[model samples]
Target: MSIDRVVEQIRTSVFSYKKLADRLAERPSERVRAMIYLKEIAAEYNLGTIEKFKNLLSFTLVKLYDDIDFSLPTGLDLERIVKENNVVFVPNHQSHADYLILSYVLFDRFKFIPLIAGGINLNIFPIGDLFRKSGCFFIRRSFNNNILYKLTLEAYISHLLSSGHAIEFFYEGGRSRSGRLLPPKYGMFQILIETHSQLDPAVRRPLLFIPISIVHEIVPEQGALTRELEGL
Candidate 1:
């Protein structure tokens, strides 16, 4: 589907709009306004995953490291599992490069590229455009108090999984500064859990949370992380 269409699908999905309308029932005019805002948010988070761009960027991204040692020795037939279930990759966050690397490896080895859920902070100039085209959907740092935004995100994610699109997001929420796994943020987890529960049993696909451990011998952001750790 075209990127615009994919976004429209999320914006118009009954999952969010119905609940939003009910929430704003007292102020009927707000329903129209809220829908407009939802459309803009959906467009903002659109994933424009183009294979040509992914392939080109993957080549350049691979050159940055000496070698990326990827091994899936579980012998679980991941390829078959991906076809049968909704795969959600929960990888540790270390460097900004972690985003493209995992997606690259997936496509290169398994011929499947999952959309990445990235922080809205990274949605800056030139690079942000590149990331979006390569399948990174920008999300706000916090939207707990914003009912519309929260529902929009949840509905967006719900549509992605039910429609058979695999996704990847960092369980740690942000890059780990201490070179160790930090306590995981439960926001996304909650959204996924709730969204899945709401789905009809016949249409709901099994969610497979794949935990990935990425160890960088020399993290790309080690210098900056050390500086921040020392209260720089």
Candidate 2:
């Protein structure tokens, strides 16, 4: 589905209805402002750009690493699973390249590209535009105090799941600096759980989470990681 349709669905969602109505009744300006904010935060998944970027990403990967090995756990039955359920992939964080490798391999092998959750820190000028077009959604690193931003993000993600889009995020929140698995971040999981509970059970499809572990022989950010560890 197009992003416009997804945004419409979110705008008219049950959650949005009450909030929008309440805002309209209390303050007209606030209502309009809320809608504009939502529009800005929603992301588009451009298939054509994603396909083209994969070739460039692959070339870059070849130049950086000796080799990348991809394998699925036995009896995973990925094709059937994707057909029946909305999929969420939670992979371990290792290096910045973890996301690029995963996205490329999935597109190449299964033609299934997932909308990845990326931090707003990486949302720079040219690179940010490229990433957003290639199915990356920018998110604030800390939004504990921003209720509106939180709700909008939740609605956007909920719309994506209802429309049958796969999602990918690092459970560790950020790349591991120690070359070891970090503690899981519960933020995305909490939003997903609440979203599932809000759906009509009769019509809600199963949401499945698949864990992925990528092993890197030589992390691309090793030098940076060492420096940061030393408080440089």
- Residue range 90-170, candidate 1, lDDT tens digits: 999988878777887887788777778888877678877667667777788988788777876776777777777788889
Q: Candidate 2 — which pairs collide?
A: none
Worst 10 residues of 1 by lDDT: 39-48
State, as a TM-score between 0 and 1, how close model 1 is to the true structure. 0.84
Candidate 1: lDDT over CA atoms?
Answer: 0.73
CA lDDT, candidate 2, residue 42: 60
| Residue 208 lDDT, candidate 2, scale 0-100 | 92
What TM-scores do the predictions have? 0.84, 0.87
Tens digits of lDDT, candidate 2, 188-219: 99988777666656656898999998888777
